[model samples]
Target: MTNTNFLISGKLIDIVSREIIKAELEIKEGQIVSIRKKESVPDRYILPGLVDAHMHIESSLLIPSRFANLAVQQGTLGVVTDPHEIANVLGEIGVDFMINDAKKVPIEIRFGVPSCVPATKHETSGFVLDSNIVESLLKREEVVCLAEVMDFVGVVEEDLEVLRKIRACKNLGKKVDGHAPGLKGQNLKKYVASGISADHECSNIEEALEKISLGMMIQIREGSAAKDFEALYPLFDSHPEKIMLCTDDLHPDDLIENGHINYLIKRGLKKGLDLFSLLRAATYNPIQHYGLDLGMLQLGDPADFIVIDHPESFVVEQAYRKGKCIYKDRKVLFETNNDIILNNFSRKSILLSDLQVKPQNGSLHAIVVKDGDLLTDSLLCEPKIDNGNVVSDVENDLLKIVVMSRYDNGKPVMGFAKGFGFKKGAIAESIAHDSHNIIAVGTSDEDLLHAINTLIDMKGGIVAVNNGDREAVRLEVAGLMSNKTGEDLISDYTRLRKFASGLGSSFESPFMTLAFMSLLVIPKLKLSDKGLFDVEQFKVINLFKDL
Candidate 1:
């Protein structure tokens, strides 16, 4: 229920003043009109609703409206969302879809102009958002900043186009987020000097501290795949003001099971970090940095706040936005409208011959994936030859990985990947990072073809095929997000994950991990629709070692 004028009583957490006081707030017309100190109040705590510093809504496999429905229940009233995933597939049309869909819900969905559409030249994206298009996007009232500049090499090498995009954001007085993982010393200095303000890709304390020292805000990322909070939590005590909390890419199951920023706050409290500091990181820090128009429980601000059981428990009981109770009684009060579906999938089914790799004389250069980390390692292993072709070796845990172009009927690019631990099935998804192409990894050629064909038939979705069983979830929106409600998507995705796990793959989020396998920007090695990309070298290398 929403009332223009209402009174709420609780122990208000004054984040700015760093104190808690029993007070009764007089909310008039969706603004905190008055705050009167009370002698006693209900046994609940009122604080500013949480904000996700950085995240990709597409990664959750739900559209912005559906994502907000789940996020608001977790006390997340706002999210700094980067629409680059969709931008790569559908360009500006995809971004407009996100902004328009977000309007159907009350949650604040701040968008950023994707700085890297294709991410790198080693991959093929359906469309490119060049500097001209980027400047046009930055002019939008809804776009607050330029998304992560994954092309760090361009900035360091003084690429004119890359610098042009940065200048556009700077000239507009907007923020330019960075994405230089493992960069340090002179290169880092040069990249930061190019006007990059914040980074959420730091996986270690030293990298985060060095960037923080250079006036770059660090976002401690704890997502479905890459987790860095444990390594960077010390910043909460040392540089609380300079750090914020974010989940760069959270899967549907993770969002449903673990909660959102509220989960991070609960974890921080258990770590014995200062309550105010943790609260500030999730609330005040990102708001100030992003210049969000959210209330901090102050008079004359928007009436956006959450009611919690207590600080120690950190369990959000209710969430209110603009004086409206959006979440209460373990349910989202508002309904999501996401019936429209937009997609850009044009790939066709592949034959088993398309998956064949002629036996080479040298060892294979395989991508070695690490569980819970985006950074991958490169390994040269002996190929298992079968019927005059190099094949998947299940005993060695090395599987055949393929990246097929979704933009056209192009031949699939084949490579080898370790760490999925798939004994007998194939998982294919059109949710590959950046490009949103069809990527699959399997232990057998038949299963791999089956999984990829299923996604092709669905236009776009995730599929896990083993024996005669097939589990799938269709992502009808840009082949990156689903139009289904959060609950439906979660149920379907959970079952697909369980089916993939039953195939003998043991990764916590195999589909999410698989999605990143084609992202050329992240690190060491990756696969693209073109070929196997060596990210460290910034080039596509031959799969056969010493070829």
Candidate 2:
């Protein structure tokens, strides 16, 4: 027989037993063969590899290759990903990119079939996946579940199409992920009954507890815009079994500066959480929940674990995925060819005349983005009057927001949004959240047009076009990320932030802030590449027709 067994000797922290003991774990191919007591140097603490229960690789602003390179060094061996960002950009092809890229890496990457492509019918997504596409994707070997079903309202109402997709997943015995924000009472109960197994969108203790009580795994998400760690760390103390950790959407700068799973692990420790429970939540829970073929240091388990210099300190010395050392010394030794051609949605320059705002009448609803949360707060604002038309008011820091259909649909919806605080020019991005559409917000009509066109010229990425006098900062990768390293991306992002701040935005980072402006799935008010959307009503609110 071939030499299929290799011994990994270390002081093991068996997640199942919650103890540290000397053991030699054996591995044959991708599975764990056996474990036995062994004499060890005892210089390291070996624990089950960390598992990210939920995350978005696109948010890392790196393709799968670079992402794996950075993440493995931090002791992460697996990630449950929802590539909805790319799905919104390229549909089936985009989802394939993520899957193929993961296949090239040593880490175990489980996918969640993207449940919401455009996130909603209102947004302009590059591609669309119906029940047919979703059902097909769920059959993949690595697909673990249906991605976050954003259309909670649609599900409860038993929209035949939405329900059809749910039933389709059920037919395949796959899990359903939830994205219900601020849902409670009977609505919450009904939503739970729809078979969503987890929710990573909780922003407060109350919501976190409520979802956990209903038997849903609450992934404490600490991502770029949505930082819920501080608010829900208490869950680790009381309900450690039901909680897991995830970075739902972290930008490149944040990833390089703070790290991924390691960042959350350290934060939990500082919050006075038990080290054992933290490790369990970070590793065991996710493994058990997904039924992954991961090792947990037992009589027969793959020799997959990490050597940490200090367990309490949470410093990773070396990381192994499937018994192979993939990362050591804070550097990635392995590389995967995971590059794809970025598709450009901008056909031509968007002019001010094209973005000219009209007046709206009746009870006007606007999207309100709560700082530090992906959820939005809807508010009613008085319309600006201009020749019997509602217009943008730079004086009030209210700027015009537009969602252009780049998927070849000619329908364009324009809305007005306050709080962007644009002082002079405009900001445009192709990395709109959930649905990667062309979203632009601006004060100066000319700059708005120029900004949109500039993004079009680059094909994809975020761009800040200042007044007639300012320079444009371009992110030319996928319109969502910079192909440059984290350091270079941060420098460029810094410049864009400063430029946007100079224009009057009050936020610390403006370009990333604008990217989420059209995320109708979050809450309150948001513009898809379609028109003014009321998430509560889940309908398009006309900008001028109603007025």
Among the numbered candidates, top lDDT falls to 1
**After superposition, candidate 2 runs with Cα above 4 Å error:** 1-11, 22-43, 311-313, 344-346, 358-366, 382-395, 409-412, 422-424, 468-478, 481-508, 542-547
| All candidates: TM-score | 0.98, 0.89
Q: For residues 1-547, what per-residue lDDT tens digits would candidate 2 score against the true structure?
A: 1224565667878777777778766677745676677775467777878888888888777777667777776778889999888888778887887788778878888999888877877765677889988989998888988988988988878787777788888788878888998888888888889888899989889998888889999988887778888998988889989988888887766776677787888877787788878888889888888877677766556667788876656778887666677767876657654345666464566555676655545645666655566666666777667765556777876677767765564544677776767788888877778677777888766777788777777777777777664444454435555455555556777676667667777765566666788888777767776667777777877654343
Give one digit per residue, the lDDT tens place, for model 1 in 1-547: 5666889999999999999999999998898999999998999999999999999999988999999988887889989999999999999999998898888898888988999988987778999989999999999988889999999999999999999999999999999999999999999999999999999999999999999999999999999999999999999999999988999999978887898998888899899999899999999999999898789998898999999998766778988888988889898888887687788888877888999999877899999998899999999999999989889999999999999999999899999999999999899999898798999999989899999999999999899999768999988888888888899888888888888888998788888899999988888999999999999888999999765
Best by TM-score: 1
Candidate 2 overall lDDT versus native:
0.75
For model 1 the local lDDT of residue 1 reads: 54
